[model samples]
Target: MNLFNLIKKDQEYWLVDQLKVSHIPNIEYLVAFDKLLTEWKEQRVAYLSLLMDEENEDWLLKRRFKKVSSIVEYTKVLDGSYIASNTFQVEALSDSRVTDSDFATLYDLCRSGSANKNKLFSIRQIMESLERELGANWRDQCFIFSQDSMNYGISIPHIEQDTTDEGRMFYFGVVPEQRCKGYGTKFHAISLELLKTLGAKLYVGSTDTSNKHMRRIFEANGCRLRDIKGIYRIDIEKEFIQ
Candidate 1:
């Protein structure tokens, strides 16, 4: 059975499913993946990314998709066991009324780290993309945490809605100047509390294997290592542009 569905975001395509796509038989999954590629080509997709277990890397490599990175997924149950700092104030982006300055801050925070080279999005692009993915209430899910009137970072936490009470973060990062000051862990702790208010019974997070800092934050916050996956990417737009 085809356990996954192809999700399109602007010109990018994402293969999403409740379980790993590698769970299905190789032969069957291969045919499905091929069909997905054909659909992307026909739809003029600019990019596509798939996160699969290491066992599925060979086949993906054979399809000309580059192994960009390996990712580790972490999970934490929301039994109100996590504590957030009262010193920091939390403000939803929607409260800013979708102002240009707030979005500019979010853009800068998102691209502060040098880890991912694909931070090519403009401020307008970032705003438009989130609006499309999360709809009208997107601003409500986006948050900025501050202390003493200085913003520390941004977090976009969302629940799965009717499908599940599971929550995940679309983006989370500390500002460049504020890095290494223990704010990453503190911001994460606040994000967990926000998830609980959003009706999330559980929280799941993922980060690149090379990111020791994020991994440490996950561990420090009482999260367990759930699984690891390999990330594969095909940038048709870049290829065609070149």
Candidate 2:
């Protein structure tokens, strides 16, 4: 497979998807992957974040890459009968106008003390991402709360991802203050119903193995573990510039 097409480029990192092939990635695949890393180093890639199938997880050791997390893909079929028992004021984010404060708060709540905290994004970076996320074919960012209290948020995809099957939910996060209050359960249930409302036939979401809090929420919603993806990262090799 072509490594170039599998990457989603960003200012800080290039997010790669877990490649699932019928046959194991042989020596040629490793050579190509190493070559890609070499080229990325020369291009100042800085960090290479790889999402790989469990089958291919061991192969990265050949390149001295370390595993950061184990990502599990959870999926469930939507029956269109889901309903949220709890009432939450759901607000859709406006595409044309999102402020820095909005992103700063959300970023902190989502990443702080979590698996992705090390991979930080500034307020400007968050806003820049919002600009891309709210563009055409992108779904709405829905924030759930009650009585002006900010609880959490969930995002629905307006278009299918090339890496996964149709009808996907991009992400959901509970605020730091609201953690362990069963807010995630309520928000996740509401999200499932909302996804069904948005015509999602199958709901797919992922979380790292170490993120038991988020995994519990997914489990509460009856989401099953379908695949285990190995997450790997490597610093750019300055000496490999040649």
Find the candidate with the highest lDDT and give its number: 1
Worst 10 residues of 2 by lDDT: 156-165
| Candidate 1, 154-178: lDDT as tens digits | 8999975344689888788888888
Candidate 1 TM-score to native = 0.85
Error of 2 at 172 (Å): 1.2
Cα-based lDDT for every prediction: 0.75, 0.63
- Candidate 2 Cα outliers beyond 4 Å, as residue runs: 1-5, 10-12, 21-42, 95-100, 115-120, 133-139, 148-158, 163-165, 238-242
Off by over 4 Å in 1: 10-18, 21-23, 117-122, 237-242
Task: List the candidates' TM-scores in order.
Answer: 0.85, 0.77
**lDDT at position 108, candidate 1:** 72
Look at candidate 2 and tell me the lDDT of residue 241.
Answer: 47
